[model samples]
Target: MKKSDINQYGLKPVPDPKGNSTGKAAGKAISRVVITIVSLFFATLFIIGIFMFSYIMSLRGEEIDIDLHSLNLDYTSFIYVNDESGNPVEYKSLYGGESNRIWVDYQDIPQYMKDAMVAIEDKRFWEHNGVDWWRTLGAASNLLSSGGSFGGSTITQQLIKNLTGESDVSISRKLKEIFRAENLEKKYTKEEILECYLNVVNFGSGCKGVQAAANLYFGKDIKDCSLAECAAIAGITQNPYAYSPMNFPDQNKERQQIVLSEMYNQEKITKEEYDQAMSESENMNFVFQEATETGADDTINNWYIDTMIQDVVSDLQSELGYTKEDAQNMIYYGGLKIYSAMDSSAQEMAENAVANDRNLNSDPDMQCGVYMMDYSGRVLAIVGSSDEKEGNMWFNYATDAKRQPGSSFKPIAAYAPAIDKGIINYSSIVQDEPIPNYFDDGTAGPNNYDHQFRGPVTVQYALQQSYNPPAVRVYQQLGPQNAYNFLTQKLGFTSLVGGGVDDSNLGVAIGGVHEGVTVKEMTAAFQIFGNGGQYNEPYTYYYVEDHDGNVILDNRDNISTQAIKSSTATIMQKLLTTVVTQGTGTGAGVTGWQIYGKTGTTDIDDNSYFVGGSPYAVIGVWTGYQNPSRLRNTNASKSVFQSLMGAYLNTKQLKQFTTDSSVTSAVYCTQSGNLAGPGCPTATGWYERSNMPSECTQHQNTNTTSSRSEEEEESSSSNTSSSESSSSSSSSSSSSSSSSSASSSSSSSAA
Candidate 1:
């Protein structure tokens, strides 16, 4: 080595021994560092992978234990209870769909649908666990070359994203979907996943679920769907409206044909089937109403229904435990099964009557509100307008409106009490001349509808003619409190009293003073007589059961307190019967049945009503303008009561109940409110008036005819009195007490 020192003496050797040693040591250090860094990176990735796996596994369906029995989740917007014939009576829309979304088991899906979806969306659905590396690589290469995004997602991955509501744009998001899909694949069979996937997907028009889409597109059930229709539906999976036949039929057809070709290419369908589907017609008939420009302005085009919705909200908040948010959510989201009492037949009739009435239709701006109910106080049907497309603006007119009842409130206040107290028989005599009331200004008097006095007339005649003067006299004699008590305390009406009125009296009786009356309250008062005095709270929901079929609430055997003696109710019934058969409500009489009803028209013609009942049902109809202004061009000549009766009396729903023969007769007095008695003297009049005797002095009287014609009038009067006195009695002090025992038993059980 000393001899080789020539290398050091000359120059530092490129191959120096010490240099070699240093290089070796440096290499060792670098190698150790590389190994450590690589180890840390892999360890971090492993931990992350483990955590992700655990998280996804935690979200498996089997791990979920939601209480199906206590979902308290209302899905009202998407559900409507069916009628006895299994036909849907109402339509509910949630998620912007036309109707409810129904789910079917995986095994129920047609094999063709599964095969078609697989062909179009993911041919390798079964082979891939979550993500396919080969597909991702191919998509990546295509994206780089063409600068367009390409989906490499499998069916499992798409389902995971849909069910979990995960985003799909970013790589990280895609990774999460992959993990979820992997977990889903492990927790459920392929069939279950596919079934859920099809149901959870969205179609157009706010529709969700395959069943809804099938019905909406093809007007058929999923199981019965045609190949052409299936192709159209399959084409919609990626972009619903983009392939909507409703909007773009020709384009959608082409799109459907493309799917059909894909199905054929993937061996999901036979060549002949694909060809037939491609050749099938794509004609779609959609109904759209035309709009008209008008000079007359209409507020609340659907005020009837809108008003009802508002009232419903109020009721839910007040009676049920629901907040504003809760109510809104329930209407839009909850799948609640609401069995409305509305009789579809009655509703249809009311709508048709109002629509076809030339007088009403002449004024394009005019609208009508009609509601029908069962004697049990359950609302059977409601109509706000003749045309449903006009919107439900007419809704809730029976419950939300506070209008003066005009003469309609008269019976509740005056006649009902007079008959109850035996103040006068149906033929009692009364003077229709002016009777002064000392008002705050110390000058007031009542008048007839024509502002003229008819002078001396029987109470029956006074009410029949809707004479305000006689109503006032009866009110004065009955005392204001007696009338008020009869309405509120006896009839269970809550709308007739309140505000500044200290006692419900003559003022309330004649509709001269009142806070306001809703159609519901006014109509319900009459229903009490229809139901023979039972007063149960009105309800729409019959029962509520959990997903597991456990009962949460049941109202099948509901009952309520008796508001009046059955005998008293019978008396009112007889008086009302007179109204329909021979009085102002004559238009409301139904052929072949004993009908009872009342007619009310408000001041300025702002409102008009006809409330009536049969043994089976009670109905109320309202016509007016919401602006408190008189309906322009209205005659006030047509009877709204007639329209409602024409509609309700013909309904098949009413035929379900057997007729009760107890109700009969017609023509009763308003003052004394009974058959002709000592107070009344019948002179030639309607049969209701003639079926009485001279004994009812307080009920009927002889009309003073021209002096020159006295002889002939006297002969006619004699004939009339004999028949009138025996006509009918509005009092039934006997029937009500007899039925109380059975009613009490059933009602208490309900409570």
Candidate 2:
């Protein structure tokens, strides 16, 4: 009944003749090939596949979890802020910490709020099952081009990532996310997926989700958010830190507009509604509540130490592969030996300075923020209050408060960048006259504080007296891009508002910044001036160790970026000394200390600043009110700084500032701020030795009589002679003091 037909091709095999055996026999031998060889090749492939599959399987973690419950984080971990002797000392313990997340049900979330998020996050969210394959393929292509970076992940995929808290940049991890997202979509409805995603997305400022973010940013629950506020909240999920509403308002406003535009383009809202939302957003004022307290119980940690705890948790999540929850858990249970960057001797001095604030400012409401760091960029001490700290984990003014720098920012944003770029130098002549079109409306130039312009002054003299016009002129020459880069990128100023908020305006050089600068950032920024031009990012911790003494996170001296030339730093260092000795910062000087610094006072006189550097440490002090008002005690910051530095320096063996061989002193005309030629009324100034100033062209061959007459004309409105006399007197008695306290107070009065 069965029929066999193996020879379907109609080929017949027969014995070959001896002559044809070489050709026909070999060709026909292909028919006699065995299965063993075929199996061997496939077997090798199978084995390799098994190895790969096993490796991928190894990388797979626990089943995808979207749970909203808190973790079991226990045990006490020791925190260290450097001791009074400048060594790591135990700060306090970490118990169980409270969570900021408070889950709201899916029904409670407003329809427009949901629309805003879906519009900005995923336009095709409702139509897609899980992965958007077209976009996925484009992302894959980009991934290949970018060499392992995975971009354009869908909302479903983002949810999978958020649930797993895994950011491994590998093909296996991406595939795992894709598979989990597909599974999740298959098991749950789109509403469920959206609910889970909304609840888990991080909105920065310690907010876990929309609910927490609404409470933190708006001082209300998510259900109570206005249409404009909802759009603002939706915008923050992309880049939380840069778009933080309270910290950097101008940047956040731009991001909010993008989100609103996305909603309109997607037909999620009508034109009329969009216009109304945009209008409301334009005038919206965020009711920013102070993140003043944490839920840690029975804590002795100050604001600085509290910041250290937060930093440790962050580093664990980044440097190690812990999630935020896991990192927090490890902070309590991982038995870690965390070391902070604080120097205790400086901390004690800072604390004492704040405690004795009554001596400087009579008003108890006048709060001060102080940041002190060594030349190597180790944050020595940070004080955020004038009164003794009351509650646990209160708001940190030293690091968090963004206030205008006024003239104190001159060295960092204006002169230092100019000097580094060779646009201006220590003794370069700059006119204190009006710069054309200085204001945005092009009305007039920056005026001197005393309402009198001193024509043609040295850079040293201009900075010494904190003149606004010269600083703005120098900033114009150097340009805003240079200063912005130097401040934000090189110096690690994270709070500067970018993206055309008039950051390019000449007013910024005179400290008219919109959001302004922080004391912590300013202190770290000044490290380059005293330490040969390398800018070290300010860090809270040094290194972390596990219970067994194994180094887990080493944060010791991150490779410093060379921001400016060492010669420029050395020259600036000497120029700063003039500010303390002969300039407006005279109140900040301590006897026998190589004190160098600049003073800043706001136009409204609400903020006062004195940022100074000694041989060993650089410190910044800001004195203002909680709700800024006209502060009459303008010298409070300088006085507080003097008291602290006097006590701190008296305890340590003194050291001189590091100088480069390329730095040398020159006699410059106080009227010209240039190399003194014949008949020039000159004063001692510092310059970069390699690029020393040319002799004054205006005064080179002038007769003595005319030179004297010209000097009188310039000096009538300026204090050049008096400044030199005070400088000479201060520099002479600088080394004759037995104690810095007595000498500083006596010299402070004299100056």
TM-score of each: 0.51, 0.62
- Score candidate 2 by lDDT: 0.71
Global lDDT scores for all candidate models: 0.54, 0.71
What lDDT tens digits, residue by residue, belong to model 1 across residues 575-686? 5665566555655666766677666665445556667777667777766666666555333223555556655666534442222243334433333334434333223322
Best by lDDT: 2
- Candidate 1 positional error at 436, Å: 2.5
Error of 2 at 579 (Å): 1.3
